[model samples]
Target chain A: MTFLSGLTPYFIAVFCVLVVGFWIQLQREKKPEEPTGETVSTSKARRWVDQDLQDDTEIPAKNDEDDDDDDHGSELDLPHVPYAPPRYPVASMLERSQDFYSLMNQRRSVRFISPEPVPREVIDNVIRTAGTAPSGAHTEPWTFVVVSDPDTKHEIRTIVEDEEEVNYRQRMGNKWVKDLARIRTTWVKEYLDVAPYLLLIFKQTYGIASGGKRKTHYYNEISVSVSCGILLAALQNVGLVTVTSTPLNCGPRLRVLLQRPANEKLLMLLPVGYPSHDATVPDLKRKPVEDIMVHI
Target chain B: MTFLSGLTPYFIAVFCVLVVGFWIQLQREKKPEEPTGETVSTSKARRWVDQDLQDDTEIPAKNDEDDDDDDHGSELDLPHVPYAPPRYPVASMLERSQDFYSLMNQRRSVRFISPEPVPREVIDNVIRTAGTAPSGAHTEPWTFVVVSDPDTKHEIRTIVEDEEEVNYRQRMGNKWVKDLARIRTTWVKEYLDVAPYLLLIFKQTYGIASGGKRKTHYYNEISVSVSCGILLAALQNVGLVTVTSTPLNCGPRLRVLLQRPANEKLLMLLPVGYPSHDATVPDLKRKPVEDIMVHI
Candidate 1:
């Protein structure tokens, strides 16, 4: 039987990912040069995303806060406004919930990836979606580095495997390694090189003000974690697959390799691309809802 | 003019929140008994949600991973198969991106909340959605405490405000307090009582094995942060509003109040509800994208 007839449901998913990947390549070929001095192949993908945000016309009116309700009034010397959001009927609400939940449920942690090209705009949209995550004190303590260069990926792979080899060979105890056996993961990481994009997420412990002053970031880990979660959702929502690969504090080397400022620390290294035709995940189980939640 | 004619867009928002509040009250009034011995109002909320998950027939076949592909084979002992996701055309993909982006963009931090009760099912669904977020080594590492108790909320509020009073009057430096001026926030937080639910998210620092052995959780902060972020999105996606209030290390008091185990620590205390008819957010500004992202 053909691929479609053999796994009808599964092929539908694969076909979608392939079509998007194909579409992205077509868009890239149409316009070889981006205005920001980026070649279509690997333009600083982030610069284009920044460009989208810069070009946004939806800036909330500055003086809108003046319309604040007198009942719950503010004494601050700035404008405020009454806030109201559209409400949907119970049916629409339930429909949306199911739609989003079902979409999210299909997402899985993928390991085997193909060295296929992804459109820059897709990555840009994912990061932009991630940036929407709320931060502590609005510190927004996260920076995304998109690496499409083979040389950089190779270097990253080398260092990460070095750490993993040590981890598998000595650092991790019997229990840890044994637990990973179901997933059948080893120190070898071919996906690091095979995947076309390596998105490095960094968390800024503090911010540098205009005068070079140090501004502390509150709940940095929390803020970055939330953003990264959204990042994964964004990627999955668009049909891309990734594994949250943490190289056990490859931060020192990564910071130097990427030339990141000292304040920024490595949070997650995501190798993003299409799952190889032969990609597979270990059959793992999630704890049931009754086990994880307590209603009081 | 009536509320509707006076501020067309603003009142439309108010009417919606009010209608939802009214609907929830009606729902609670209709059913006054729940299996968990909870008052009909709160009990139906979570039970219905739990029922949804329990009734889900879409659990993937456990042995699907056994269908391994031999084409690009893995040496490990396992089965793998080709993964193909359905593809949408460019227009549809772009539309989805924009649709999700605008929805997220409209999400704001709400403070003034109506005591209008929210369905427990909604909260359960939101939490379940949040749980879908990937975590470090798949440890999950988060617990959600859904507190609808009035007495508990009152007690928690008193301590939090006590701490906040000190933070505003003595603890915070000038710049910090001054920065908050635009938001018009004070030590007094009446919303803690005004909102119907308090979702206190606790992060598990480590897991206690059956034999009382300590199992260290890797990247706990990162994992919990991502989960919390998804929690916020889940809430907003379902027409609810909340504030990510960090009671700066209220862990000690909360741990006591909630009677949580020692291993679990407070991460965030989110008060969830519909915005008060008079709710208003400060006209805050996010840093331009150019400032936050770098292309490498």
Candidate 2:
């Protein structure tokens, strides 16, 4: 009886220690360490596929933790400037609206592309425009890889085509095949090499904090997708053309090929350039406005 | 042995019949009956919730299967007009680009809202602008429900508050709570009622073909998200401010409340209105261009 009573106190003590230990572990997990920023290299950009020495500098890490308020750190902070929109009469607004609609309506998915070199500044502007897309909690979780090297384009095309062959023959069912028939796209992807640039869009599934702690990213797919949409529009604004090509089962290979960090996943591959003279799109009609829209 | 031999012929006959039946079924599923067009109602647009009767005319049915070419059916078909962009000098392009950048940079996520009524035509124009957003296979898989009814808004607000309470109290982890603390948001969402209009964006997961056949929607999430990006830009162009509010666990109830078809799922809830007399956003800074963008 004496021994039993003594053992009870010891057991309770052990339980208390375990509970405290668990609580501490949970707290540690809940708070990730602040990320340390990386120094960006100003070296001339080179295609990782073509050259053995690629720019190994990591993108500057962002601290998403402390951004609960509107105030950001004052280091290199750009002052918020006042903004005033130009007033337009109803007629002008209508005219502008019609013009925009007409212009956007002309955008078509092009496959037969010319290997015309696009200026770096134009591509940069398109990407910068894409960055304005809204995201969940303002976590802009996207990476744009612009590839203009002919050798790199060949490599990407080969990898994509290999997987696409399997997808077309085996992975995709009859319905998917039938749905794609009107587009007349086969397993072959000749435009990947023909296009002057391949804009590979990657979505960061999670953020890597200091000490390699993972931060959760919300709406990663949606955020990247929205950015891609804006990128398309921006390209259109510059009179450039692109086709959205999602290469299924090519992410792992692509990540390794591009030497991307482990946290990123390939979302969509857009081949950007001018359309070939003989380029023709399937005469696909868009759904009527009444079919797609409803007002209440 | 004699009985087995006699049954072999019967088995073969049954197999042949089954094959023929399957082929016939597949054929029937491929081509849907041409949709009978509906006359759009031009009656005075009224708040559907306020009146016992509502505009019941169905949106024109789109023939997704028949779009083998660029031409649509002639019946009530909006003729395609030729597009020719006015050539702007390089200086003008640069000016326009800078102006667009400055204007878009000014866009902030506003929470403090005003109850002043916005014009119906303005709301309609925003919705039409959203319609111009491109979709996968041009399916145009989106439905925007504009809610201005005070009673409906109140109901939506109540429902959202209930879910947000649960999310804040229990569903969210400590990290999530801490992350949102900077934004100073809570279970209370009075803006749902305070905003003059609530644009409920719904994504069509799949198309319900005529006679109940299920048609696949490619890149559904990405397509709808892109449409939403354009919608936000379009709203901005019209000088209207909106905040993106994603109400979790409110989809099923919203579907029932809005009387939407089964194929649609709520994607985003946007409260549209003028900023209150004293509207303020968090001074949070966006990640620098080097952090968010890359060119190689």
Candidate 3:
């Protein structure tokens, strides 16, 4: 009777975990209906406010109060403004030919340590460059969290290491461990701490409020990844080195550590700084263009 | 008895489709594993033979044969030298800065189009620019299928229109249909046939051989999307305009129309050409940098 009683608690614990896991899996897979009513209005209002302010002209304080009423009133009275098509400048064929090959060739992935801190202006410029990436429905569902604080860096390192340790020791099987063996990596998590700046890229899966309601986003993964690519290119163009790191099991840990809202999901952890003295990458080779490209 | 027999056929059809779909999903999720046994040596041998012939070395071919069998062959083996990375001397930051910024500032999406044929070289260069995207583990899992032949273009138009007709009629709910009502999209198949080129971006989820086993790729979706971003930028950087079109329930139809391999999945359909002379686009504006960036 006592043994049965003891096992009952354990069984109950197991059942609870299984139920929670299933619920999480279901939530991840569920495709929410398209958002309506206030959700659409709020996003529309935010977009309107952003557009009005992006121009150099400043609104007078008197106009600002009128603008607030206009925003709500216009929603009911007028048709919503259609999304503007992007307009790119035309470069002469000859001019484009001159530099096209060089810009294409100069792109390279850099990873190493340099102790110098990247200037705030340069970081700002790079972020500005990344903002040029095209997004789905122009929602631009991305957030670039640049961390330069020493204390926060240390905290991130500790959190990432804790999760990585679990991954390395228990979660990953032998095959995964073997594949990663060639690359020099450690649970020490020094890069998270030592790098002068850490850029945590978060993908807003959907828009959410303090209330549990959510707004739909289209092609969330594709949209966010495109933004990341542009960000990397922008950073590299400025002659900075960065390494993309994704601690697979550390997403939830990071959410808690960063006090992120539920709608945002951690996409990548980028460590940006100068390469260390004597920093060397693995002897790796990229596939040739012929191998990668197929003109059909 | 007749009813039961008819139901059996329907059940069999459903079962077959379910099985095929499950198999495809499984293949998509699978990751490539390291090859076992003598795969590495065989690849090395092939590379060595090609390198020696290219170098114009006078060493006897039999000497190479003997070298391959030697136990210490790896140590004494000729080094696999990579071709020098391409350089572009004329592409200076100063010269291209203005053009880059202008293009960046002016980039706009073009929806309405003219039936104008873009120059072949323009399309080629834009695709060439897309080829510069970096890949995961250097596995560039993308194939650009350019549709230019009249008959193929016509066939694509038919397929796309058929899908869009269904989307407009029944598939898309009232809300989605209402949201998209302002945009001038149609079930008419003219754009596919009229555009100079239809670039179909196919993501290779896995590699398959007639006799050999299939292998999976990592981050194929992200890699393909990044490449698409570059393609879009390249098109924008040049003077050509493009519209990324997704017809409802058309991916499978596209694969069938193109006679694509089972391992390849359609990522996007881009119609490339000059915009129609009278065409107009939605007046969309991008969010400001401050709204997008968060510094900690």
Candidate 4:
């Protein structure tokens, strides 16, 4: 009894600690359900994703104004003006819609690009058209880097080929070996060199505002991508052929090679020129309009 | 000394427990650095973002084939065919580029839409044009919901307005009051009721394949956005107008209202029609060619 009494305080101390430890463990388990400061792996499926395209790169802006469609940007402060764009007659509108659909429908991602030099001014006009896309808060968050130089194109090709080879081999397992028969080309991008122009589309993750402080470009990826859609339409309008290639993990290397600012990450790379006379594409049918559209 | 000796074992037990507790605490501290499988708040910009649009909603696809631009889906197994699309001469190509640019550049987001009915067929052709956009691995991961019924449009408008009002009042504290002067429209969206058609674009994050298993739609959001870019160009081509509004936190409600599948998440909402006679847009100037393009 004396021995027990002598040891009683130490035993109580141990008991108290065990209770506290278990309580802490319960609290710790509850914490997993809440948001932590740790960032998400937006590139998790594999290294095959263009890791640069994730929105996590854009740090959370201090201002609440960044995410919404404030549209006008700094120019958002600009005055309102009466906007009366051309409104065609119903018949003419129908004709125009059908004509445009016919033209756009003919567009296919062609891998074999002709070596013929495209008119520089034509490329300029297409980029200009793309720039006209509406961005979040009028912050035009796209930079089109047109690479026409042969040596630079070769370097770009080399960088892409190296990473793509790694991606193709490493990303694919035994199934990839079986699917190799189904794979189009095994990472050899001849069009990168052969095409007259390599239009590298970069989305500015953030922009420097007039105060020279960083401004958040909200929906920057979507904005730049929408702009690319218009750019594709422009290219198709001029009968140019190029494949939309979002090179996996090659954004950093390409950004450096193109001497673009750190904020600009490559969203897409298009090799612009005519299709080779012998160019071939996989005969693919798009989902019919009914399959894609639901009348509610 | 005898009492102290009596307490020795208990003391040893207490000391050992504290050391273990310290080790456990150290482990607990380290855990927050790694992912706890908790979802990311992709909509953290505010409740203003469409939470449904986050990539985290899609389960981690078991197949390694999910993320890359394999271009051909199940159809990827199809044979490549010779492709000779129209080849325009240099002069014609230049002319076409200028023509298309002039048309697309005239496009703007006009908010005050005319109530006059637009032809349904024109909308169909425009959607068909949008459907022609290339997708990652040929998973045409887009659903366009066209609402022409006045009642459904009103319901949508009600849902959007309630959320937008909450969004406007709650999100902006004192600064939003100041920025409201610059804001074009308040939470009241008359165009939702006034427009001839409301097009809600959805991105299928996953698809039910032939095996009755889910397939990941890689780059689905980007794919849908690109398709929208084409949709916008198509609208512009037909002399129609729309204001691209991504309603903050209104996606799930709208999704349920539209009866879209679980895999479909709202990416964009456009109120489509002709601009009202008195419609006015912010007198906005796009970035010039040199500003957006880098000739390397």
TM-score for each model: 0.71, 0.71, 0.65, 0.77
- How well is each residue in A207-251 modelled by candidate 3, as lDDT tens digits? 542344443444555676666766665554444566666555567
Off by over 4 Å in 4: A1-77, A172-183, B1-76, B172-183
- List DockQ for all candidates: 0.14, 0.09, 0.09, 0.23
For A162-203, candidate 4 gives per-residue lDDT tens digits of: 987765554433223223334355689999999999999998
lDDT of 1 by residue, B100-217 (tens): 6667667788888899887777777788788887776577888899889999999989988987776565444343454565465678889888899998888776666544555555
lDDT at A276, model 1: 78
Instruction: Please provide TM-scores computed only on chain A for all of the candidate models, following their numbering.
Output: 0.72, 0.72, 0.65, 0.75
Model 2 lDDT tens row, B1-296: 99999778556655654565467446645764411111112132111111100011112125434323222122111222222234345555455555555555666777777787776666666666667666665667888898988999999898888877765655554445556554556789889989999999888866765555556566666677777776776666656677876666677788788899877888788999777755656556666667766555
Tens-digit lDDT string for candidate 4 (B1-296): 99999878656655654565467446646885332222223232112212212333233445424433333234333455567788888899889889888888889988889999999999999999999998766678999999999999999999989977765554433223323434355789999999999999998877776655566666787788899999999999988999876676688899999999988888899999999987767666787788999998
Native-to-model Cα distance after best TM-score fit, residue A205 in candidate 2, in Å: 0.4
RMSD of each: 23.8, 20.8, 23.6, 26.4
In model 4, the Cα lDDT at residue A37 comes to 21
How would the docking of model 4 be graded? acceptable
Better of 1 and 2 by TM-score: 1
RMSD of 3: 23.6
* Of 2 and 4, the candidate ranking higher by DockQ: 4
The per-residue C-alpha lDDT of model 3 at residue A88 equals 34
Model 3 chain B lowest lDDT segment of ten = B49-58
* Candidate 2 chain A: worst-modelled 10 consecutive residues by lDDT: A46-55
Look at candidate 1 and tell me the lDDT of residue A174: 40
